[model samples]
Target chain A: MGKQGNYSFTGHIRPRQIRAGALRLRATFCLGGFSFLAFIVLTITGVLLLFYYQPGDRAFASLSEINSVLPYGGFLRSLHFWAGQLMVISVFLHMVRVVWSRAYRPLRELNWITGVVLFGLTVILDYSGYLLRGGQESGAAATVGQALFTSLPGGKALATVFFGQPSPLNGSTLNMFVWHVFILAGAVGFLQMFHFWRIRRGGGVRPL
Target chain B: MDLIESERPQVPVEVEQSGSQEKLPLIELQVREYIGTFLWLGLLFALTAGLKVPLDSSPKAAAISISKAPWVFGAIQWLLQRWPAWLSGWVLPLLSMSVLLTLPWWGRKVGKTWAWIIFLILSLVWVGLTFVYWSESIN
Candidate 1:
């Protein structure tokens, strides 16, 4: 017996005890692990980006300087961008894998639901990041986003709550910066921990 | 496989003992996670090192007429081009999410079918929109 002999950890099992097809890479694609990795990468790169980023009208200019002037700043920005995109892709794939494997049955449903919410957060995180860039693309996205928000039921109030007033010199970009840097990211992290806890309670990965 | 039987997890020891069942410490999983993450980071750096982070001029003076949303929002952007903003922007995404949230309660076949159908439709729309945007740019 190894030192880990029946250690009774919450979310693990002996590697040998997996089902016939369970050990195959296709079963899960290790997406959950990859998504977590992407999040961590994003966090580190995002923090690095903060030093160079100035929200609002100067946001675009700040990004330009970061890409052109700062040491390895472009690299950090690129890493953050790629990590966010990777997180979105992996999280979506993770959900698909879960559904495909029928892993949402019975006691596992809560985790599935949490996963869905996480997907939404991940998208928003990506969107907010783009908006922080304050490029033409981001400006258009913000306009559309505001339109979408206002078009929904109670959307006017919801938009106000989320986006604040859209003044020419308004703090919307700064608001988005806060969300991208802290609130949304923190929420996703918290939800992810809860998600993992739920999975643990439901018993690790479901056998394929 | 019976739903009831499938719901009960198959213990590894009872299932297959092809000498694959090396019960290592949970730390092994953590180690694997770190290695996988590092490799992914290395690949990401290698791939993106030469590629610049795109910042198109600036929004300080650009006209919104030719502006576009990120690729992920391409589907909604297309729908916005074709349909009412509220419908495409608010209703479509919300409806899809609603369906997704409630999917687990549906019967297995029905749930899976709906999921696949929704995923396929949305993905096709997104891809099609990307093509449309690209073609428009080229022209």
Candidate 2:
């Protein structure tokens, strides 16, 4: 009964499951571990990045300050960058692996869809994180994004767009950060609920 | 009229592991087989922990497209970008529904492997275009 296929870490875990040793756990945890690690890094560095990064025209100056004056700002920034990219890559591989395994078959379909939605929200939230920097890159990207959004029927309502209009970058970029942290934050939390619910319904990620 | 003494299931490849012939209880499923699912997803979450996306300071507009959502919605997004969202939403969902409905029926008559192959081929092409021709939209 100590099979490696149908795995479940929830509830009273069996001794045999952990018996696989560090190598298996390490290999298996690489993806899940990275996700947990990146989230921690984001919280820490995101706060640090905020200290020097005030939204508006002064943002570029903040970037310079972080890059120049702030202690290990460059390192922190790089860590944030690396973590975000790594999270995206890991999430994709995770989904693909789930599909090929036919884990979504029958009763688990809801979770698969939930995972898909969660994945999309992650990309959106993560995206807004980089965009809020309001640096030259962030500013330019916002302008283009505004254009793309404005192309939609009611895109101007987004407040992130404008054609030769005063892009919100002239105002406060913290709003973008707030949107990323708050709006999308709630959505991601809901997704986790669905994931757990599905797992419970399907009786731990084991096969049918 | 003894031309054909066929005493075999027409669809040899579609293995129905259910009822008596079921592969037995306490089925085991491996997560390792789902490497793509975990790795990419884990990386995304990991990146949240201060992992850098590693972009140049210049912040090229083109780079945005490279920052993608997931492949699950890539086809939908690709179609949305090319066509109207209404058409993309309604038609795509309908088509998918039709395909799923016919899948079991088709697999029973014509091998399951054949059906899987078709789906696999389609996924490969779509997935290929996703990584290859992906628009560099950062969002």
Candidate 3:
């Protein structure tokens, strides 16, 4: 068997050959592909932003500097922002498409569950990113999130673990920065790889 | 001959179909992927260049009433305004998530058409709430 026919890593990523029907634009409408594209854009732009972005008390100032001072800083920041927003939207649309095609039935059920989890994590990542802006609006948003957490039993401790100490004026905290940049984003990246692997293992995209 | 053929390993139906169907080289898919990436990147750059994402007022400034959450959380925030935190923040959202997570099981139980309907209604409710929240925030 040639490389395409083998179950090698490259083959898993893109098989040596695909059913002609699956190649049609409508087979998947490429929504999942769009989501992954947005993620790649976000990761690149996010790393660029990280060079100058500061968390905690300096967070807003660092962002302001990025917006106005650094060369092309604002453009990179805007790209990151828009990509995050687009990822959320595309993931939701992908879920809708999955349902419309009844792609979640039987053999594909596990993939659907993984997708649902990814969607939820994407929303939380967006929220956490908002908090990292270190503005009063972020402060208010953080307050609401903290309130939600605290409403649960032993919620106060959970709130501190996730939110750190955010005042009403600034929501940015070292805790949130780590979560947004490392933990949550890392989980999404790992899960996305698994999701793609599962899709390939399921005999690639089903012909429409 | 029949006995010997029966002893041969059977390819799964999906794999068999994949092999039997008219095949296209992986390059075909790669080309499409490339086109998509370029078009998507073009749109992102166009958006970035055309519209500046606004920075919030400095945190040092007097705190102003923020009646909005990020648009992604707009629906939950809208509900939070009308209902108790536990209900709006926890129960309803969790219930919706539960419904979504179990959709495959629902398909098996209620049929695919009904499952689609259930999902559509759920999605409409959340999207509708987010729009309502957006309008109110702007007003």
Candidate 4:
């Protein structure tokens, strides 16, 4: 198991060597890497938040306490918020970079599709995170989202599953809490791993 | 057979390289990543420390005159106010997403420049709408 053990999951994700051209700032602009970095920041802050955050009716109150009472709680929450916003912007920019470089063509097409899906999920995750704030604004946003979901054929059940009976005054719900923290976040994490692996398997970033 | 063919990774074209084409150890890239990570984190911390994220009015507060969507959904909310829910909320977004999802195929069919133009137009429209919504909110 000497050298063979080196061929593990981490090894596959980060190969021993890369094309030197990929190191140039102009080649990829590191937008994808930036986006992933934001994700890592968000995951750390979010888990910390989960320690004090309460879902449903206690949502807003819990957050207020975290903001005012807990040590560095507000800072952590602010970090999570900024990181979330940055991730959305960076992911969109990364997509633009991919299209600009024509990296989505041919062998990398699946990665592009995965990226698009990830983009959609990122936006939805942002929206869901907003709802978790349990403010009047969140309630309004939830209303709009629910309306969009219900407009589809057989979408009433779908809306219920996703929005989970949010009140007009407060959007936080156990249902949305699970989706935001566990389901959507988990899927993004998994897809990102697949995305990075695909890039490596495709012989690293294509040079301009 | 067709599926396998479609999934096949593209073969890299061999080109005569100058002295600069040397491959480097992954640690070099990792070092760059670490630097980038620190820089990015610095910007995030600066933003967090300088600007406070305001909490929305409490749920129990009297009904506010205006309720805004999160900035990310500002574009959709802007449209929803003017257009039918079906159009603004559902069709337009789904249509835009469909266009984005098919961009690689667009590149193949109409050429890369056209595909890039199509993507740019789509991105600008949504981003423009978001800005418009934000400006209106501020005013």
**Tens-place lDDT digits, model 2, residues A16-131:** 22112222432244443344445556667777787777655565566667766788776677666666656666665555555454444545656666766666667666657656
lDDT-best of 2 and 3: 3
Tens digits of per-residue lDDT, candidate 3, B35-66, equal 88888789888988898999877899987987
TM-score, per-candidate, Cα-based:
0.81, 0.56, 0.92, 0.93
TM-score of 3: 0.92
- Model 3 - which docking category? acceptable
Which digits, one per residue and each the tens of the lDDT, describe model 4 over residues A66-162?
A: 9999999899999999999999999999999889989899788889999999999999999999999998888888888888889889999999999
Q: After superposition, how far is residue B35 of candidate 3 from its true place, in Å?
A: 0.9
Clashing pairs for predicted structure model 3, backbone only: none
Rank list by TM-score: 4, 3, 1, 2
Off by over 4 Å in 1: A1-23, A165-172, A205-208, B1-24, B62-64, B109-139
lDDT of 1 by residue, B89-124 (tens): 878878877766766776365766776666567656
lDDT per residue for candidate 4 within B1-139, as digits (tens), equals: 0124455454445522543356788888888888888888899999999999978778888977556799999999999999999999988999999999999999999999999999999999999999999999999
Task: Give the alpha carbon lDDT tens digit for every residue of A151-202 in model 1.
Answer: 7778988776666554332223767877778899999999987887566444
Give the residue spans of candidate 2 off by over 4 A. Answer: A1-33, A159-172, A205-208, B1-139
After superposition, which runs of candidate 4 have C-alpha atoms over 4 Å from their true positions?
A1-8, A205-208, B1-20
Question: Which regions of candidate 3 are displaced past 4 Å?
Answer: A1-7, A206-208, B1-20
lDDT of 3 by residue, A9-58 (tens): 45566667766766778768888999988988888889999899999999
lDDT of 2 at A128: 70
* Candidate 1 CAPRI grade: acceptable
Model 2 chain B TM at 0.43
